[model samples]
Target: MEWVYIENISEYEGKEVEIKGWLYNKRSGGKLFFLLVRDGTGIIQAVVVKGEVDEKTFNLCEELTQESSLIVRGKINADRRAPGGFEIQVKEIELVHLAKDYPITPKPHGITFLLDLRHLWLRSRKQQAILRIRHEVIRALRDYYDERGFVLIDAPIFTPSACEGTTTLFETQYFGTSAYLTQSGQLYEEAGAMAFGKVYCFGPTFRAEKSKTRRHLTEFWMLEPEVAYYDLDDNMDLAEDCISYVVQRVLDRKKEELKIIERDTSKLEKVVKPFPKISYTEAVNILKKNGIEFEWGNDFGGKDETIISNQFEKPVFVHRFPAAIKAFYMKRDPLDEKLALGCDLLAPEGYGEIIGGGQREDSLEILEKRIKEHNLPREAFEWYFDLRKYGSVPHSGFGIGLERVVAWICGLSHLREAIPFPRTIYRLSP
Candidate 1:
């Protein structure tokens, strides 16, 4: 009585083993029953013959329902047409628990209805595939950074001040002091960069944005990498290289999972290095050419980003944004005083901005002035200023939103499907 998983059932072909899982589906024709069983790993078909088994076993098959837990002993058989190219001839059955009529059935379910049951919906085939692909994407990210000598640094979840802005921060009272949820780990990684030369932090970040857009998430995961002495161009190079590697790894390892999610592999295959680079001025020109009434200094919205990205076959780096539109930490372009040396990597096929970063302001005087210009509290950022005050060199960093990348890689229509439990502006249960 060997316990086997459906994923590795092929190894035990022609051998009797026990499979402990839940019934996915079932069909019976007079004397024969074909039961589709799925464990967490994979799915397989188990056949039961009435004459071959006792009356009790055949009767139990008749009473089996969807998602009913059971342990069955069977001999593995290779079948080309079966799920995962395998099948089983059942010899015995043991019921663990009979699930009372599952709510999510084979019928078409509304989005709200499906989201309400997100706890159980994770067991569905599509969700499982999406999650598996997500797992591989995360694995690829870790592998890319770790092999490149980047030190892993865990940033604090709460901070005395904001990294991006105070408008979207989640304010909280911490022991009679005001603390805000971190919007990005970029600032903390800057300190780490000074200490380790190349450092990165991968963790959950919070933003209290009231946006209901398809690409916005209140709570999402971010992978921010900071490199000491890396300028804007060097930062762009790292971003393109890292992204190319992660996408290829997903394609190589998660082929079957990609097929399950119906993603067009060709699109991802085109995501190689040497991605097109354009300036903020050029991107505005593109928008104007496309009949968009976009101003030169304003930040690009979702629609504007899609229009510019659609012009290229690969992810495009739009750099040298107006200093007014970028964060206060970004360094101003030496060639153009009003432009910040920042860049955003926009995913092709209208996926929007996936990565954002730039060379940070190394001059303590300029950084202090920028902080004052942005009307930020100077005392809260005194420790941050110390990084520049002590020993600051040309440093750059960028953050990649995990959910946005997952949505783009999976070709998902909405950001909610990218995460296990989505917390949107409206929905936040299960």
Candidate 2:
């Protein structure tokens, strides 16, 4: 018998094939047992009729429980009403393992209860769809960079100092010396860009923040792309193109998954090139006109981003924030000394700030001054500063939060559902 996956069952229509997977659900009507099986690729219904099989095989179908591992030999049949538009006529059944008393039943459960059993909950149809879309998102990102002549560079998770600031750094002891988990790979990617001209890093980032909002995650994956000789305008253009490309890829390949999550693709369909752009001053003015009191120099919060993004049909760029509110590495706007040449791309429909990036301060004198002004440890950044001391050209880069993008695209209510095992401020378990 030919071994096949549920996804490829359509290609093998009217042909007998063997499928290895776990039973997702089951229902019995008189002499027929409808077993819903999922093999991670997709789900399909396997019909086991008592009259068509021997008593032993019929009895085996009755004994199968939820999540039981089994090998099913069946003939694929097209059924417009069935899930995935196909059904299997089960002929032979081979028991692999009978899952006894699966904790997660078909009944509705509370979020806390489900989160406690997340390891098992991931096997559900909804979770599977969300993760599949996330996989496509990452794949789309890699393709976007690879096709654009960007070199892949791996950034270290452990660092001697903070990338953003000290307040949110996750401190760890490394050989009796205090180290910290990387908050952003932008600093390392800057070094890589000097050598490769254009480089990107994708990895897990940690932030020891105590925020318990729907958007905050203690640990999340980040994709940072750095390019040499790119200014603020070039950086914004690249960000717009990169994001539109990724969203387009998801729309093209993950249509079924998006439907499974019940995401409204109408807004996503409008995500294309030349996304609307506005300066921070304009954004603040718009917020004030909308009765939202926001200071001009203050950084935009989650609510602020949502308000700004809602004004546009697609992802919107808000740029040129106050220099003091941004990271020390961001370059100051040449025309305005008090404003940093930074921008944040806020996803529409209340998904805020999926991308943040700006041109780097290439002058060694300015960098050293900013480091001292921020009260950061000067000695710890000696190597980072050395990049400027040597032959340094204008460089720009941006970091996109993968889970946040996934959450927005999948229409998830919380960021925790975007990752397989989310590490939050209050919870850390299987």
Candidate 3:
């Protein structure tokens, strides 16, 4: 059997091609019929002429429903009016598998229903297109990091230590001790930076949250990179450059898929490097000046984040959040002692905090005090403290939520549509 993408059909014109795949759709116009076929890579219409083939082929075409798998031997022909500028002239047809009463029809399906049938619905042209874009985006991320001299490091999924807090991690029993699923590989990736200079980790992260928000997921993928000898200013620059690189790579490589998703190029075109940055105090002042009723010490709420995102033409870096609200390990500003040297990159269109990061505290004394202030187990973080006692360079890293980033790029309303098997609060089975 031979498989070919619909895009390259022009080269195979007049040549007999053996193709096998599902039937996307079938339409009849009097004596002529068209069968839309897609084999993952692309789609093309196969034309079957009346009285030009055996009775079995004609009967099979008449009875075939959508998504029925078949092997077809056909001659390709140039058709100026065809969808892909080529049509397959079938001479032989074989049913390798019969898909009966498919759940995902051409009719409209509610979001809940579509997500419920995600496994089977993935074969649809739209879903296929989104997934292809997602794949390209992931590739673009890896390429951007690899080209920038970043060493890929794998962080452990099961760890003896807890990050930030114990409330969000998924704890499991290993032998007798407790092993928690990693929420953010930031700490371990920071350790890797100390050894590898510049390191990155791309893998699944788990969060056990009861909140049922479109922005929240029970399990998701995170791409985090840490750099030694890098401060908060350096980290913000890296974030902007990395994001633009990913966007530009997607725009260049997945142009066709982007077109399929109807992503507004105008918005994406504005995603250039050197995003605007504002200090924590400045950001708070801007919000207050805009008539937002917010206190100085409170964390930015969802509405505040959306308001801030709408103001920026590109992704905006809002830095120096209150230290009291940030993680214990975040470096506190010497100038202000109350705010940490951290930032959250808010993607445009209310993408809602695609990145969260800050410079880690390098002073062993300050770190120990902060850990105790948060009521965290200090013994569990002795290994992390060792870096401070030793030669600890200024280091910073950030995590990009893979699904949220994909959703923003693809112009999808919710992040669940970005992943193949999304594990949201309401979803787990399939």
Candidate 4:
């Protein structure tokens, strides 16, 4: 018998093929048995008749339990009522392994309990759809940069200093010396940008955030892209275009998956180019107009972001934030030194900032002064300062959190559902 995946079963209609997978569920009506089987690709229903196969095979189906591993030889049949517009007529059955008392049954489970069994919970249908969409998003992101001549550069997980600030850095001992887990790859990618002109790094970043918000994750993936000689305006242009392309790619390829998770495509459909842009001052005005007690120069919290994003249908870009509230590496606006030449792209429908980037400080004198002002160690940032001392020409870059984007696209309530094994302030195991 020819081994065929459930996803490709449509091509072999009326032809006998073999499928090897686990029984997702099963039901019996006296002489007939219906088995729902799932491989990693998809799920299909297999029907078994009492007289078609020998008594041993018919009796074997009775013992098959949930998540029981099995191999079945069957002929494919087209049926609109069945899932994936097809069903299988089983002729023979071979039991591989019988699972006993699977914990994840067809019942509602608490988040903590399901997360505790995360290894097995991934086998559920909803989890499968979320992960599949996540894969498409990752592929789309990589293709976007590669098509635009961006070289993929790998950044180290261990760094000598923090990229954002010291409060959130994960400190560790490095052979008697001190090191910290990288909060962002933007700093290293800047050096890569200086070397390659256009570069990006896709990898996991660590943050020691103590908060337990739905948007917070201790460990997550980031895609940081840096370009040489690109100012703030050029950076925002790239950011909007890149996001639109990625969202459209998902809408094109993962329609069924999105439907499984019940994502409102209408919100995603409006993610085209020329996203709404407003300065920090304008955004603050919006918050105050909406009656949100947000003080200017303070970073926007979750509720504040939701109020601002609600003003537009598509993802909005809020630019030129207060220089004091931004990272020390961000370049100050020439027209207004109090403002930094940075922008944050906030996802609509209450999904907060998914992308943050800005022009880097190009002057050695100014950078040294900013570092001193931020109280970052001067010795650790010597290499970073070298980029400015040599050939820095107003380069800009941004990092997109992969989990947050996946969470937004999938319409998931929590960031934990976007990642396979989420590392939060409280979770670290299976």
Give candidates' CA RMSD values in order: 1.1, 1.1, 1.5, 0.9
Best by lDDT: 4
- In model 1, what is the error at residue 263, expressed in angstroms? 0.8
For model 1, residues 92-113, the per-residue Cα lDDT tens digits are 9898999888998867899999
Is 1 or 4 the stronger prediction by TM-score? Answer: 4
Error of 2 at 273 (Å): 1.0
Put the candidates in lDDT order, highest first.
4, 2, 1, 3
Which lDDT tens digits does candidate 4 get at residues 225-295?
Answer: 99998999999999999999999999999998999888889989999999999999999999999988888
Candidate 3: residue 77 Cα off by (Å): 2.6
Whichever of 2 and 4 has more TM-score, that candidate is 4
lDDT of 1: 0.92
Q: Which lDDT tens digits does candidate 3 get at residues 1-430?
A: 4666666777888888877788888898556779988877788888887788687888888878889998778899889877878889988788888888888878998998988888888998778878988888789889888999999998999988677774577889999989999988888898899999999999999998786877878898999999999999999999999999889888888888888888887898889999999887777887898899888888887888888888888999999888988989899888888889998999999888999998999888989998889898888899898887778889999999999998899888887888998887778968
| Tens digits of lDDT, candidate 2, 1-430 | 9999887888999999999999999997679999999898889999999878778878998899999999999899999868788999989888899999999998899989899999999999899999999999999999999999999998999998888774588899999999999999988999999989999999999999999999999999999999999999999999999999999999999998999889999889999999998999999998998899888898888888888889999999999999988999999999999999999999999989899999999999999999999998899888899899889899999999999999999989899999999999999997
TM-score of model 2 relative to the true fold?
A: 0.98
Off by over 4 Å in 2: none
Q: What is the TM-score of each candidate against the true structure?
A: 0.98, 0.98, 0.97, 0.99
What pairs collide in candidate 1? none
Task: State, as a TM-score between 0 and 1, how close model 1 is to the true structure.
Answer: 0.98
Query: Candidate 1, which segments miss by more than 4 Å at Cα?
Result: none
Candidate with the greatest TM-score versus the true structure: 4
Q: What is the lDDT of residue 52 in candidate 3?
A: 83
